[model samples]
Target: MMNESHAGTARAALPLSWAKRGLVSLFDSALVGGRPQQRYFAALGMAEDEIFTGYDAVDNGYFAQQAETVRVDAAACRRTHQLPPRYFLSLGRFVPKKNLPALIHAYRLFLNANPQSETHLVMVGAGPEDFQLRAQCVKLGLQVHEKSHIPERAPASGKWEQQRGSKPGVHFYGFRQIKENPLFYALAEAFILPSLYEEWGLVVNEAMASGLPVIVSERAGCAEDLLEKGFPENATFTSISVRRAGLRSKIRRNGFVFDPHSPEELSRVLGLLSSVAELRIAMGRASRVIVEKFSCENFGRNAWLAAQAAIEKQRSPAPAPARGELMIPPA
Candidate 1:
């Protein structure tokens, strides 16, 4: 059994073709990460029974519980870290594939459209593109505040909110540990993952579990299964509801899905979420409900089922030799 997820426009060439051939010849079954990944496997002539989705997941319970704890003292955490009262959160490596430049440009457009909006863009991560991204922020005239290192398990300083100087700008909170992320998620109003090509964005899961509306790139592997939500809060969460919501997902989006290449589209989404508090709240609630179905336990169950299926297939006897065909005996 194989467990890999790489299905995006960027992977469209000789490499992917070779990968498909290898997969078909080498693996009897595969555990995929998302619905889009199933399509990739299906294209390789794999049967539905041979392809298992939902192989990627995070500790939703841990993120949720830690976020709840942060919420209990959100004001203090925000002040100590000097985070904006309301902001858009983006958690990922600052790489070209992650499309950090496009996000920053869209954020500029969003700020231009709503000059009075208080929402800021907070990016958390470090990579080779770190300096380039910071330069872009500076060229755009966006105040770039850098919080390079966060002490692990350090007590929060009792700082006053007014003294922290919260403002609407781009904040770069450098690489954070798993335990330190919930505070950033808890204080955020929404999450954005604008990757040019993502195999499976697990940060989307973390954000959803933390109860924030998400804006995901259409190219992300998880978008097909985790991005769309259009039904009202009162609607039941079922496959039937999903089908019904699919009809209105384009017009009545809760969790937004946008083309990563189009900064205008992402800008518009940012503006909408910033202006409408009610819409943000509704979408955040829906995100939590949707992400609950894709828990770590669900991933474990699917993996076990796939392994069992592979074992069963192996245990089945080989077909009888054709008539007059001689079988060679090995010494």
Candidate 2:
């Protein structure tokens, strides 16, 4: 049998306890989402070959194709959708665990520091936190526009100078279908997922496949495998590291990773990406390169390998009974 781990905190400990007692081998094989989970199982006594990585996946090719189609008429698509010309995208539920409030606060910080900047923060998805998140935007003096209310001729850049009683900073585009997501992914400068905790953010894969650089929170499960030059577990982005290397130097080759709890780090990262157009282009390309490895083909191949390995193990003869040990024959 091959099993995937998706248990929550309390339930997850049961397997660890079993593994500690040398019982984990009861399963023929196991698969994990990424290296982070792989390290966790390895630490719990799972063997290297018994564990497969990259089990969580999405149809990268589909999203890539959709994004390409949208790119052909990107300008018109933006107008039809009432989307800002250049903005960072956040696509996920508006739940507390997403830490959207922190993202909004960081965007505020970035705006305060870069007053002349015109890049908006476009949020797509609705959940319990919708009302609260919108309220937070209002409190921070950042205008919130629902998808329907956005002007047809939304400004290509800068504040909503043309639209009266409207500000252009944070947009709540509401929920989008899977097919419609590529439009936003295709047009955005970059994608961001600032979840406080996520088992595996498939949206990260979608964004990467759509050729958008990502700014993911370190706590996201995909952060380790999907982010280029995966964030160092021990690498602290404290004020000390920021000063020593400078902000530009800290930008990872693929994208940025920040502490979800630290709005300051997220703010600085936003500023860095916004100022470096060349870097964004390069990083977006890098995202495509990295995500290609997690394609549906690779996922199927890994599953086949696990099944083959498990079958071979099952066909092998059982270990001979030890001295003074009783063995029961198969019924």
Candidate 3:
């Protein structure tokens, strides 16, 4: 039912019990949208009789239209320098919940294992927790690049160079305008979202729409449905073991599972992605196919239908109580 837990403290301040009851009374089918969230709603007194889940869909048409608006004008994008062969792009705030540390560790491993690989990682987004992450990346012997709003000059502190070695390729593009993001996405070879947990990774879909291969963590809710439904038949599913559970479980395990705690595992996956061009193209095509199904038009239609059904059921009269004698006397 569009659980709002992601709002965290902000949601907790509201009158959740009243809100739940009000919502239940208003709709026929209460569709719980995220993993772990259905249970949260249940705890708020929502019953299985009223709750519905299992099918998670988004308005893909809206996103597709949004994707179309990306600027093809290279001049607007400001390509100050040539991009590396395999650009590892990550777009998320430098927050712990976004799991930047794990990604950093995995990236270190990936670089160490393939020193000759002409790959560069571009992280977009900044937050309070960025300093420590920057320090860690430097300590690990990986190059770091910091992009700023004032493009005329670089940071005077020399911190970026100290942490990233001389002529670092890694960049922190401060805050590009929203319209300019597609330009950055256009430059990348592949998209990586190694979050420890995510309700639905919109960026994964966005990257796929941009025609880039994606490497997302299993914990992401979108991985269960979006990736599964969209993944190419030939694209290899990492982390899932068919030897343990055969094809069905393997399919279920595919895109939705990964060891976020292990950098080595992440490195291995990225390594495989970088090493094989055919695999990347196949996976990219599969991602596009899957994303098309989730278009905004489809999501709006389904959401409307689901809402209508719920309203219709809610409007129907409740069955009369049985004519049994009252168990307790009226006060």
Candidate 4:
């Protein structure tokens, strides 16, 4: 939600007295998505000690394990196709907001800078932007991954179709084994998502959970929230408390966050990630750590706690009569 829209201003006009009430909250961010229907309960009006945020997150454990499985499968896929050892992975519909067309331009720039490098750009998923994506690939003298896919119909082989075309740098492998897609995370040196405008790009969460270093658009919600927790210690988390205080930190060094409007900036990030293997490993580890905090289980447990807190508030006894005031009880 790019703040300051007409509706947002109207909603922000909500009464200030709502702040002065008994409450519990589940706001995602402090000020994002308008003034928030909760106002102070959304973390602004409540005492710092009482605010809660039931923000959304992906299943870290599930995605992580799937990534490990794909890690093994990655080798076979790479060998069978003779794909490049160093490559970047992207997953999303070919929508304009996803900026795949711009990503292709950035990929071209990356190739121009690293002509001798064997790095490839393999983007998955399909949408209305498919034809232009392919045209851009061919226009830049980039090779395409020829695997026909119908959005619904199964391929005759009952597997993600895979074939080779005679181009080198960019590979647009449309739809593949829908179930085994997480393997794409295992096969990449890094993951990139440079959206034009995204309230939240969940693929960022999946990619990070899969142990791939990420480069997200600054405008994407996960760009900040994924990095919000910074680095977690090497211990198992038993629960997620309702407070936003514990996990939130200022030290976010997980991955690159660049301007989506600047193709040169995206190209620079791609080039940097492509050239530095050690950097990718370190950042990818940090990504794994950060994502662990935002796991599906953690999100659920924390939300349960928040619900309990609100119920407790609902059930609490009001203060007894003070001075001349009369006491009243619920009938």
TM-score of each: 0.84, 0.82, 0.72, 0.69
Candidate 1: C-alpha RMSD after superposition:
7.0
Q: How do the residues 265-324 of candidate 3 rate in per-residue lDDT, one tens digit apiece?
A: 777776766766665777666767766765656555556665776677668856644564
lDDT of 1 by residue, 51-148 (tens): 88778788888888888999999888887887888899999888789999999999999888888888889999999988888788778877776666
Ranking by lDDT: 1, 2, 4, 3
State the C-alpha lDDT per candidate. Answer: 0.77, 0.76, 0.60, 0.62
Q: What tens-digit string does per-residue lDDT give for candidate 4 at 1-331?
A: 0121112223342343233222112222222221232233433333333334435577777778888886777777766544467689888899998988788888888778778777888888889988888877778777666444433333344222234543346655676664656767878888889787775667888888888888887766566567544433332322132112131222235667777888777777776667656667777788898777767676566566656655665577345436532212233
Per-candidate clashes, comma-separated: 0, 0, 16, 2
> Model 4 has how many clashing residue pairs?
2
Q: Which residue runs does candidate 1 get wrong by more than 4 Å? A: 14-19, 150-167, 235-254, 317-331
Candidate 2 lDDT, tens digit per residue, 19-98? 43254545566667888777666665666787787688889889999999999998899878878878999999989889
Where does candidate 2 clash, by residue pair? none
Model 3 quality (TM-score)? 0.72
lDDT of 4 at 23: 19
Say which prediction, candidate 1 or candidate 4, comes out ahead on TM-score: 1
Please estimate how well model 3 matches the true structure, expressed as its whole-model Cα lDDT: 0.60
List candidate 3 stretches off by more than 4 Å: 4-27, 31-78, 81-83, 150-157, 162-169, 229-231, 234-257, 317-331
> Quick one: RMSD of model 2?
6.7
The number of the candidate with the highest TM-score is 1
